[model samples]
Target: MLASDVCPGEETIAAYVARKLARDERDAFDSHLDTCSACQELVAAVARLAPSQSADPVTSIGAASTITQAAAEALRLPGAQLGRYSVLASLGAGGMGVVYAAYDPELDRKIAVKVLRHARAGDQLRDEARAIAKLAHPNVVAVHDVGRADGDVFIAMEHVDGVTVRDWLRTPHRVPEILHVFEQAGAGLAAAHRAGLVHRDVKPSNIMIGNDGRVRVLDFGLALADLEPGTIVGTPAYMAPEQQRGEAVDPRADQYAFCVALWEAVAGRRPEAGGRRPEPGGRRPDPGEPGTLEGVPDRVRRGLRRGLSARPADRFATMDELLSELFPPVPRSRRWM
Candidate 1:
């Protein structure tokens, strides 16, 4: 008997293929594997051994198209409906869970929902959900509801329709536009820091620019209330040296990431990761200023340099400090409204 014939389980092969191909190009292999019973059995065996913990018992399907094989055998779970809301479509998937765009029939609004894929082996979902719920800020995406359904943990949050700053920067941004983003991001970080939180992940991908010209910081999955050691949960490209080393990090780590992102936007190329900048034509710019950014202004370049300082002490102590220097404290009533 084939693996499918021997192993009888509810987890389907189509879901398995979708999860596996989540990051790679979607192709015929996924479709064929979905219909092959032998392949399905192999997938089931492998899934049992894999470290997957989905919030829903059903498997995740990536941005791949449907094919005969997968379409024929894939099991379709009911769309998630919690309280007065119904999940409409998948937005994206993170390390531990997936985010969805959901409709609330009672309020007649769309909300963002994050459901845990698998409960942590040690920690309860309630604990994590409560921690996240405490965060409330205009700039930070708000957590409205959190709970479990059919053993799957979920969180309903305010949805902001937007594109990530990183995606927006794939094309060049004008100097003013870049500065606008930095200013708003700095303010958001300042608010979170004041509440005794540090956003462990501070990359372009985590910063969003909405169609309404508002900037909102997204994803607090890696955020923590207190600075601590031993959590390795930030994106490698944007992580501070201390974070990568698993050392205790403070708000300065976020400043470092902020500077790195600013540099990428202004400099038009990623700064060398190890810092030092290869002597830059044998003479570094004045202590807190960069020599080049092609088109970025002097004030913005200076700020970027300070944020990317080699030593944490050299960086701004708080996002507020950075924001004050970039944008004065006065409220932009006209622009904001």
Candidate 2:
């Protein structure tokens, strides 16, 4: 009745979708799938994900600079193969997994593929990828497909050409430009919220601003549809007080993270070290106390402070309310109405 109980060497989701199993084996696996919703849903989605559209061209490729060729090769790079895509170059490495720019010859496009570090994490990745693929917002990174190749789980995604918000913050940016990009990032979170999902991780590193001047929120690796209490997950520096306490989290948690990161972008420092690491649950920094706040407009400063409030109820009730405050309506001319 459980996927774990299923004997090893059964047809993988990809193999099942590809009809690579022998008749008897396929029938047995089909019988097993009836009780294994995880594999059943995975195989269904993978089948539905078959190349149905033309590829969107990636104007640019390599954006991240880390993990050298030799290092990547050790991770099975350069000529490494995963499902329908082949590795082209290492994009970056992170806690979730190493990302590689890959070529999907079937789709005839360059896609960024995340290869999970643990062979056992295939189910988790499948759940995460399914949730992300359902989110189709412009400011959200697009998940094209997911598959199991050999002993690895890989997610093929739209390759973004740009720097993370953290790296982008290293440069000088006018307040308007900063808020504009962040608004896009917030929109991505807002969209996820509307879809009943919460981005448990919302630090600057998860946000990307492309060369095309578009801001995208990437990596739903830590996202959850119904985040319950006592689920501590996210960067400590940007976590909401409730999130740090492992209490229930909603979209407001992401709003808190957004403000914290935005304040850092403005002040060039984190508000407060909530904790030394994940689940530290330390005090949050006062947004108004940062010396740099003097240079920031009162309107923006006030909004950030409310968003960084210790209590979720005290913050903007929703992302729409937050955006309304961040970018207030221009006094419409009486004539325009």
Candidate 3:
């Protein structure tokens, strides 16, 4: 290869293609691969030429030798077609799959296409599409289509041009600004609850704040119509007690997570500092006890406390109710007729 074709991390390609890179190193490479076109082409070439008989776990690419499944999926080059969408570039990857920025010729618009990691996840992907498809709210990411291509299941969704709420919170923001973003996200959650679906995962990273000043709730991958008991899912820092215990969960669980995220954003600390899960049958924090949230307004603190209650029953009946508490409505003025 020419010197111009060489990338900084070229040495790791053999280990990466052979699936021998340490977990952290591999993850670092994955992030690097997203933006490094030269590295991507190098990795794809190495995978194609590497021996197939290696004992390492093999992630096939069109009947080729071993490669990390995530790498294989993310290597879909520009101009590659997944169904009718022309892949432009990889957006990112998560536990479930890699998201790509693509163009739909039929609609003549840019879209996000998430290609799942496992073929068996097709059913779950369909489930997520169905859940989000039910809501037409501005605060929710819209799902456009779901289909399979080359044994991979994918969901095409609205391409959001903005930072995640977690990223948005990196800079210091006013209390009102934080609440404004979260209220819109909460509205999306409320809509999902009304549609008989629960977004099992609600964290700052899952919420997006578009450049247009719109807040949207995305990634309903863990959403479910029924809470299957004994199945624990969600980010640990934001999971409610019920979710931690692998017990059946409802919309209130999402309320708990929302409060945790909002509390962290406003107070600069989570109500539960360490992402600790309260033990089953553990004593709920005394509602009257003064906690870490010192400077927060009385009403906002009270609202967050109730939402973070260990027992779901102690939480606001619905996401709408919690939102009202967080951002109460102003009373109308009475004028002389």
Total backbone collisions for each predicted model: 5, 2, 0
| Candidates ranked, most accurate by TM-score first | 3, 2, 1
Lowest-sum lDDT 10-residue window in model 1 = 22-31
Cα error, residue 29 of model 3, in Å, equals: 16
TM, every model: 0.66, 0.68, 0.73
Query: What lDDT score belongs to each candidate, Candidate 1 first?
Result: 0.60, 0.67, 0.72
For this target, which candidate reaches the highest TM-score against the unseen true structure? Answer: 3
For candidate 3, write residues 220-258 as lDDT tens digits. Answer: 655522234585555655778778678888899999889
Off by over 4 Å in 1: 1-49, 52-78, 82-84, 117-136, 150-152, 224-229, 273-291, 328-337
Q: Kindly provide the TM-score of model 3 when superposed on the true structure, using C-alpha atoms.
A: 0.73
lDDT of 1 by residue, 1-337 (tens): 1232232233443344234333122223332332354443344333332345344424432212322233323211237575556878766553445567888787888898765544442254455556667767666778887766655556788898888887898787787888788788777888778876677778787788887888888776554222234745555445566765677788988987777777777766556523543242212233243356766655666676676665677778888887766666667568655
Off by over 4 Å in 2: 1-74, 117-128, 224-232, 273-282, 289-292, 331-337
- Positional deviation of residue 19's Cα in model 1 after best superposition, in angstroms: 17
Model 3 poorest 10 in a row by lDDT: 57-66
